[model samples]
Target: MTETSTEGTGTIEALSLVPKAEARQSMKDFKSDQEVRWCPGCGDYAVLAAVQGFMPELGLAKENIVFVSGIGCSSRFPYYMNTYGMHSIHGRAPAIATGLASSRRDLSVWVVTGDGDALSIGGNHLIHALRRNVNLKILLFNNRIYGLTKGQYSPPRRSARSPSRRRWARWTRPSTRCRSPSARRRRSWRGRWTPTASI
Candidate 1:
């Protein structure tokens, strides 16, 4: 793979993936030197392990994979990866990943964001990126509570005692527009992968 740059845009030119005989990479190759620093027993640890394990399957060079994240506990992901990445502003990971993916089709771009970051502030960017099919693997860690904010209730938190609990309950009720099965089908048909699962 090769990359070029355009003046002032800071965007990488299209990469030409001329696969040559190269040695396979191990999981250690993707592991960074940074100390794994998160609260003990946090779910992020498992998520991190899962991602690191899967990276080798892609068979891409470490330099060609990028992890972009937004502000939150999950945003710390880029720091632990031994690949090129960006720890960007709150709710902007999708937008940044879109630009990078669109500009460098040869690179595998992934976004790591949490419920508050992706569903609350970055919701628009996330939906648009999916609609445009900008070649990205987005992982939304919906732990419900804001881990970085010390257990504060986030957008996905569902508890009677949660902050603004009633407001959230009201919002969860599907309106007429959101209840249409055809609309959901149309949206899903446009994307390559859009799966939701509890971790």
Candidate 2:
């Protein structure tokens, strides 16, 4: 195992001689007993499921997994996971995860953040973590609106639109390429009404 620093710099000093199958089983043992809780139609459900399913593939010991999240509707991720986790303050998940990732070589750190909690006030921390590549899996939930704040507009919202709607548009942009032409056309209707420049 190797130890890292809070500054996002580190080196792997030793190789684990653990066999692949044994390591995989060890990781699987770390999964927790909590039931997932997210809105029926919310994207968070998928994100959570994906993470949980993917985690065991790493084949690390259960003690090596850590999930940290900032406050938001999405921040509840830690509660649903069986592994070690921290439901941190608003917009501070990355910073907290960064520190943990830098200092703990045995742990696989993951940060779960939302658009409001991350981009709004935690933007600086997010950027630094990404740039430094601090051996973390940063899962950003970009729903556009501040769901925990009762559907309010978030920082990622466009300036020209209502805060609530602007966030939706911002979140949807990344999916445009994957969408069917008909879906893209439907989205274009909103573009015309709101003006593409606003987005």
lDDT of each: 0.69, 0.63
Using lDDT as the measure, the top candidate is 1
Q: Which regions of candidate 1 deviate over 4 angstroms?
A: 1-21, 161-199
Model 1, residue 125: what's the lDDT? 82
Worst 10 residues of 2 by lDDT: 187-196
TM-score, prediction 1: 0.74
- Displacement of residue 199 (Cα, Å) in model 1 is 11
Predicted candidate 1 versus true structure: per-residue lDDT over 1-199, tens digit per residue = 1132213122222323412216787778778999998888777888888788878766777888899999988899999999899999999999999898877776778899988888777777877665554556677777766677665556655554645555535445222221245434323222222223343
Which pairs clash in the backbone of model 1?
Answer: none
Which candidate ranks first by TM-score, i.e. highest? 1
The true-structure Cα RMSD of candidate 2 reads: 11.0
Give the CA lDDT, 0 to 100, for residue 153 in model 2. Answer: 62
